[model samples]
Target: MTAPIYVPFQHCDALRTLAVPYGCGIDTVGVDPASAAPAGIPEPTLTPGRYLQEIRSAIRAMRALHDLLPPTA
Candidate 1:
């Protein structure tokens, strides 16, 4: 058995063409919370309710930003 290969998200498009022939799988990673801390800034602590509220607020902001972008093909 072979282990899966980790390919960067940006390079996945190129790898797609070779993945099947090589009989290997490619995976991409998402956010690494351990490294998400801002430089020179301390992380904040939040209760469960506050955490959920913050997450919801972020989603709303992202949706608003996405709506501002022009339509694409």
Candidate 2:
């Protein structure tokens, strides 16, 4: 993985990697789903190359659209 450019901010006392440059968006999720990575369960893993490619693809798609999804009324 590329070196993290942003120092991780403590969230609930856990250090989480920052995806600033590549983060397309963020949404709240259930606690169980969020714990998978921080807990190191390792059931699902992505090779760095493939992961970066997917991230680039996602950012491109989002940029092409030119707007994020609207909030629910």
**TM-score list, all predictions:** 0.39, 0.30
Which pairs clash inside model 1? none
Measured by TM-score, how close is model 2 to the native structure? 0.30
> Each model's C-alpha lDDT?
0.47, 0.37
lDDT of 2 at 25: 42
Q: For residue 45, what is the lDDT in candidate 2?
A: 48
Predicted structure 1, TM vs. truth: 0.39
- Write down the RMSD of all candidates, one decimal each: 12.3, 12.4
lDDT per residue as tens, model 2, 3-66 = 1211121221121122343543443233333343457555344468856765665555545333
Tens-place lDDT digits, model 1, residues 19-69: 534656655454443366568766455468865765665565556545655
Lowest summed-lDDT stretch of 10 residues in model 2? 5-14
